[model samples]
Target: MEIGLVGKPNVGKSTFFSAATRLEVEMASYPFTTIDANKGVGYIRNRCPHQDLEVECEPNNAPCINGTRMIPVKIIDVAGLVPEAHKGKGLGNQFLDDLRQASTLIHIVDASGSTNSEGEPCGKGEHDPRADVEFLTKEIDHWLKGILERNWDKVSRKLEVVGGNVEHAVYEQLSGLGVSEAMVVLAVRSADIQESPKNWSGDDLYRLAKAIRMKAKPMLISANKADLAGDDLMDSLMTLGDDIVIPTSAEYELALRKASESDIVEYMPGEDNFKVLRDDISDMQKSALDKIESHMKRYGGLGVQQTLEKAIYELLDMIVVYPVENEHSYTDKDGRILPDAHLLPRGSTAEDLAYAVHTDIGKGFIRAIDSRTDRVIGRDHELKDGDVIKIVSK
Candidate 1:
């Protein structure tokens, strides 16, 4: 699944991207520093079953780090969005189009209220961060509405006169946005527009667009620059109540990761604290680390990792399943223990897992053996989190 990092310019979008993916992108205090979208793979931690199985895992797709399995998730950092972005303002269309494949989005807002609506540097607490949230959602809603309004007369006439399926037609129009037919149906229902498509009002269209965007591209809020934010500002963001707001310090996270890379500190992404590995460190570096530790202690580990994990595990409702060729030994054909980790939605069936492993394996139509229980299960059997199964294909 792809997670799009979105926000106004200089709200640490690039810094968050760099920290999360360990890939360098241009970062600056000015708006629109990122002209092109940066794509990279970021990982979410999962418990490696090999630890429980008492076997050394030779991973392939994902790496196992000290008993923790790091499952890769695609991350795209798009250009900074400005107000009226849907109206083609400030790299508007490009930004929205870049997020077409994103299953979800992480909105990085300056919680310190240090950035204006245009993403320019402003006085602290000058701009309300909550307004940033509203504006971004509104821009997306308008963008989707514009897409739906295109050829609306012809399409709506076809839908009403030809008695075509409304959900399917809408789904077709928004297929590029990763919108599913199921999402269209739910959006239509939630929109509660009883009128026929031909007679639907502008407001009705906007409502439908909003609903579709809600389901098609769910979002999590990252209240960035939290270290510089006051509790009152943080409290205001929390009162948003609709989205999950996480306080993050991307600068601090980047610093910690860099320090870890240099072996100056023993740090883990999600850990609340780090250890200074070298005693000969400069006083200036030591002070910076101490401040970062204090901030991390207050907000819980820089919030960079937490935001990513919440987007995947909670927002996406994904679970990791291991497919093994040898159920008894929990190894692939090459004798590597639990080599691959597949992220599947909660309630995915054995047949689905087979398809995920390979189309040929799924086409063969097989039974599966659960390594944990050694019980033979049919193709329809639903898989659970951390399941290790051997596909017995014909």
Candidate 2:
């Protein structure tokens, strides 16, 4: 699954991306610093099952760091969005298109209110960060509504004549956005639009579109630049009901990672503290590290990693499963122990895992074996998190 990093320009969205993925991108203090989308591989942390099974892991797909499995997930840093983006203003079309494949979005807001509606630099607290959250949602909602409204009269008439399924028809319009028919059905149910598509009003379509966006592209808020924010701003963002807002300092996180890369500090992503490895560091560097530590102490570590974890594990409801060729040894064909880690949605079955592994393997339609229990499980058997299973295909 891919996660899209979206925000108004100059809010450190690129910084967040660099911090999370350790990939460099152009960053500046002005709007539209990122014109094209930057795609990189980020990771979701999971406990390595090798630890429980007491075996050395020779991981292939995901790396093991200190008994933690870092499963790779694609992250897209799209161009910054502005108000009325759906109306084709300020790289709006580019941003929307870039996010079509995103399973979820991380809205990075300038919690310090240092960026204005146009994403231009402003005095701290000059703009209401809450407006940033609300506007982005509305922009996406309107964009979806626009797509649904196109050729509505003709499409609805055809559907009415054929007595077609509204949910399926809507899904066809939004499938490009990675929206499933099941999600469309749920959105329709939530919308409660009683009228047939042919007679549905604009408001009805818009409500349905909003519901669909909510399901299809659920978002988590990264209240960035937290070091420059006040308690009032942070509290206000936190109280935005139903939105998961995490205080983050993308600048500080990037700094720490850069330090780690240079071996100046011993640090890991998601760690609450870091060790300064060198004592002969310049006073300027020491001062910067001291401030970051204080900030970490105040807000419980840099929220970049925490926000990614929440987006994948919480919003996406995903679990990591180990697929091995040998259930007994948790090894693959090359004899690499615990070779691969796959992230599947909660309640995914053994069959789904087979398909995830390979289409031919799934088509063979055989049973699977649970390595932990040494129990033979049918294709439909539900797999749990950290499951090490070997498919017995023909």
Candidate 3:
């Protein structure tokens, strides 16, 4: 799953990316600082079963630290968006296109209201961050609307004349939008447009486009710059009612990660606090570390990790499953204990997981054994979170 770190420029998108992935990108105090997209792997922390199984796991593909398993997910930081981005305003055209690959978006909002609508720096609270919340989604909606509007007339005519499969026709029309025919059908239903396709009005098409964008690109807002934000600002943004808003200090996360890299302090990305490993520290560095500690005490961890975990598992309804060759050892062919932790959609079946591992394994068509009990299960056995299953195939 790919989560796009998106927002207007200079709202800490690059900072968040750098912190999460420990990969550096340009961060300037100007709009359009990111001209292209940067892709990297960012992990969500979970408990490694080895801690409970009384065995030490040799990590591969995923990272395990102090019994916490870090499942990596791809994150893309793209160009900033502005008002009427669908109309090609600012760097809107390139940025919107960059978003097509994202399964979900983490909108990094300048919750301090330090950036104006165009991402230009301004006094704190000058621009209401709540306004930033819906606009990006609307911009995305309008972008989809633009694509659908281009062919609405011709496509609707064909649908009306052909009169067999509306979903296929609409799906074909939006084949480039990264949505499926089932998604198109649901969008049409959600739009509540009961009339014939040819009879759809401009407003009807607008609603339909919005629905399509909603299902195609689900998003969670990260109320960034939270350290500088007032409670009133946070309260207002929270009232915008996405319930998925995560207050994040990208700057703090970056600082902590950087400090860890320098061995100045021992820190984990999502942990509530850190430990000063070395006693010999300068006064200035001590003050900075103390300030970070205070912030963590106030609002928990820096929130970069929380945003990612919520975006992937909560908003996207994903689960992590372990597939092992040796059920007892919980090891793969190479004797690596729990080397692979696959993220699958909730309710995925054993066969689906087999396919996820390899096409050949899935096609061979056999049952699976529940690792916990060694109980035989059918191909259709639904996998659950943390399930360790051994597939028996031809």
Candidate 4:
């Protein structure tokens, strides 16, 4: 699944992207630093079977090799969203368009409330992160509304004939947004549409838009610049409810990674402390590096990893499944079972997995053997995490 990182400019979105993917991008403390979307593969680090087996292994059922351990998930960093984005303000249409392809959204907010409504640095502004959060959601909803409005005559006319099946009409309108047919079905079934379009209240429209938005709803707020946010900001953000708000210092993590690569300091991104590897570096520089490293480890990669994973699993309700032929020796397309992990949406059945492998296997119906338990099950069997399935097909 693909996830998009979105927020107002200079809220550390690029920094988060760079830290997560370890790819370099231009990051600045100003608006519109990223004019276009940047795409990269972010790997979810997990132990693979070959690593666990500690031997050269191969799988007869699926493609894999020896000692492969991690799988990659795509991440797209879109341009910043501004007020009136739905109305075509500040590259608004462009920003929203960039997100059309993403399955989930990670709304990265400046927890410290250091920026104004337009994403400008406000040294003395109140830390009301809720405004940014709520505003961004509304913008997206209205953006979709605008699309519907443009096609209202055709969509509304169709809805009149279909009656209660207005959901289908709505789905047709949203098909361009990259929403799948299954997702549209779910959204329609879950939405509450009125019998008469004119009778629909403002709240009714809002709810319909919300249902569509929830199909690609965002999760987790990366409370960036946490070290600078302090207790007042933390308490204020806690009041926003039980949403996973992870405190992070993207800037600090980026600095630490750069310093480590440059050999200026011996520090890791997720480690709390660092040993002074360079004796030639000044004491002030060492002190500065130590503080940043402390922030990185304490906040844990500035919540980049947690936020990305949380958004994928919680917002999108996805899971990681490993399809392998040999539980003892797993492998991939290249015959290397280097970390056997594939993130898929929950409720994925065996047939779905066969499709993931190849259409030929899925088309030719057959039984599957669960390597972990050696239990044979039909094609409809739902897969669990780390499942090694041997598809006995034609």
Q: Could you say which candidate leads in lDDT?
A: 2
TM-score of 1: 0.95
Per-residue lDDT tens digits for candidate 1, residues 188-276, read: 99999989889888899999999999998999999999989999999999779779999999999999889988889988788899999
* lDDT at 6, model 1: 96
**Tens-digit lDDT track of model 2 for 201-222:** 9899899999998998999999
Q: What is the lDDT of residue 31 in candidate 1?
A: 21
lDDT of 3 by residue, 277-349 (tens): 8889899989999988988888888899999999889878898888899989989999988887889989899
TM-score of 2: 0.95
TM-score of each: 0.95, 0.95, 0.94, 0.84
Arrange candidates by lDDT, descending.
Answer: 2, 1, 3, 4
Predicted structure 2: lDDT: 0.90
The alpha-carbon lDDT assigned to residue 178 of candidate 3 equals 72
C-alpha RMSD values across all candidates: 4.5, 4.5, 4.6, 5.6
Pick by TM-score: 2 or 4, better one: 2
Runs with alpha carbons beyond 4 Å of true place in candidate 1: 23-37
The candidate, 1 or 4, that scores higher on TM-score is 1
- Which of candidates 1 and 4 is the stronger one according to lDDT? 1
